[model samples]
Target: MSTIEAHDLAAGYGRVQILHDVSLRAAAGEVTCVFGPNGCGKSTLLKAMVGAIRPWSGTVTLDGEDITSLASHETLRRGVALMPQNGGIFPELTVIENLRMGGYILKSRKDLNERIEELLDEFPRLRERRGVNAGSLSGGEQMMVAIARALLLRPQFLLFDEPSAGLSPKLVGDVLKRAAALAERGVGVVMIEQNIREAMQVADRMYVLAAGRNRFEGTPADISDDRELMHLYLGIGKREEGTT
Candidate 1:
């Protein structure tokens, strides 16, 4: 599977640049985690890559095809999906309602129903709560709905912005577990997550972004062996004795 590549991408809200020549590649069938502090433009990088924010310069290419100018809807049509930090689901919509809306791009009712049924089968909790309002579900369940909704689009590359932002510890782990499962299914997953330890646990490749620019990209082993590096980038100190 081909990867999504962002080359020298510089983008932000009007007249304010958040990303500074950022470049990274997320290959299909792997999970690439972007770690950084707040105000580091992690979400902006996601926005730029998905064409939600047009880049001041550079290109977002999927398998070598340029998509920097595509609108958000058009980008999704290209089989790239993004689940943002917030507003990914309709609070008032039921589980089935949100899942059905996910396949709205396809007009065939039969196909839509089939897809929805397939997803429902895969996510049994959603199936059980098919009638419950989304706002009524637990935080992890709501995130499950978001994942199910994104999968309905049949995307090859999925980008998640801060999947574990405000959840409890258990819920945060649950969310990352779901992301890992997506990678196992051969979806190219690029996620910006603040839960550094959990992110490292499931990542195939780790990219450390500081101040909106790419700092370090390496395997998990690289991170594990470099205590000082973790301290410098993530403010994490060495584990004390008997703290394993």
Candidate 2:
């Protein structure tokens, strides 16, 4: 199976360490959700995995090959793409134009156009607003644009950073369902999320990060049943006695 594994990762910006001994594994056809409080190095972990920032130690392996040092573009070429937080889209650009930028690495216009059409079919809503400026769309629509753009390259693994941020509860579910749908289509998905309840609904496996380290890694059921874990990391209040 195709997998992206980060083992014993320790990385951060200049003179400040944000992650320490963090590890995670995401496999093709599964959704692995990572959760934690703010500044727990959730985004930093994704950055390190995709080479947005180099790890001070440890390795990021793609199907067993060490790709820790590869540049972001190089990793993208190797079928791993990171959709950064906040739906990275050009406010002034139309939906189709933003999508075109996603395929900038493709050498042939025919291939690019074909890929764009394929994604449009997956996200039919995007087709309806292809000519409209992305910033003018609703939060959910903008997320669809960002996701479609990421899929233009047909990556084997897609990493999402807080994909549900700045959206209504309904849109959070919508965006997370899209992430789960991508996994169903055989793409490895690693997502950083704040919506614990919703994320558990779609995640095949879960990893909880705290203080820049691995705190918990288990199936959704495992997390829900653990009172301490639910209360401490997932922000769920513990069930009281006789509350069956």
Candidate 3:
């Protein structure tokens, strides 16, 4: 079964619709990328799916049950986690403290501690900086912390928005590698990315959004080879074969 599915979802900031009758799905153990120009409602869709914003219509289902109207915390408890475009970390807290906060919903302290240790091993950067204030970390390091915090919840589906937003090429590569690893470990990943080439490289399937609606859905090869798609979505005039 698909890990998360949205059917004809309509949502927006109070009175102005950003997503219009949108529908999409992310399957278990695969990455489904959502690519679009800025302001096409990619983040908004993530928010809606995670119940950060209530949809005006349609339904969002997780593992076959409708969860469209659940609260954000409620959704998190149901095993859906959203890591927003801006890495959401508590600036005042230490890295380990921030991770502890993500485990607020956990009922078992032992499980939480075990998960934190596992995440620390998986992300050594976080382990090394665990005692430092989260805000002191570099942008890429902060992003890594944000992702690790979300994983502490042991979410079944993860929504990532612009995971490579403001980092050096190397860090962007690192972040995408981590995301790919998450997919490999059986967590469903839905990513909204501005870096089309990197996002497509990690994605098993992709959806192209334009003007607040889905314009195309296909494999990376389908989009990479289509000059019109590159020109229109990414504003690149032309790209050589194997460029992305």
What TM-score goes with each of the models? 0.93, 0.96, 0.94
Q: Worst 10-residue stretch by lDDT in candidate 2?
A: 235-244
Residue 137 deviation, candidate 2, in Å?
Answer: 1.7
Across 58-150, the per-residue lDDT of candidate 3 in tens digits comes to 999998899999999999998899998778889889999999999988889999889999999988889999999999998988998999998
- Greater-TM-score candidate between 2 and 3: 2
Best by lDDT: 2
Looking at model 1, residue 6 earns an lDDT score of 93
Total clashes for model 2? 0
RMSD of each: 1.9, 1.3, 2.0
66-96 per-residue lDDT for model 1 (tens digits): 9999998898999998888853889899999
Clashes of 1: 0
lDDT of 3 at 52: 92
TM-score of 2: 0.96
* Cα-based lDDT at residue 85, candidate 1: 85
Could you tell me which residue pairs clash in candidate 1?
none
Clashing pairs in 2: none
Compared with the true structure, all predictions reach lDDT values of 0.88, 0.93, 0.89
lDDT of 1 at 230: 86
| Model 3 regions lying over 4 Å from their true place | 237-244
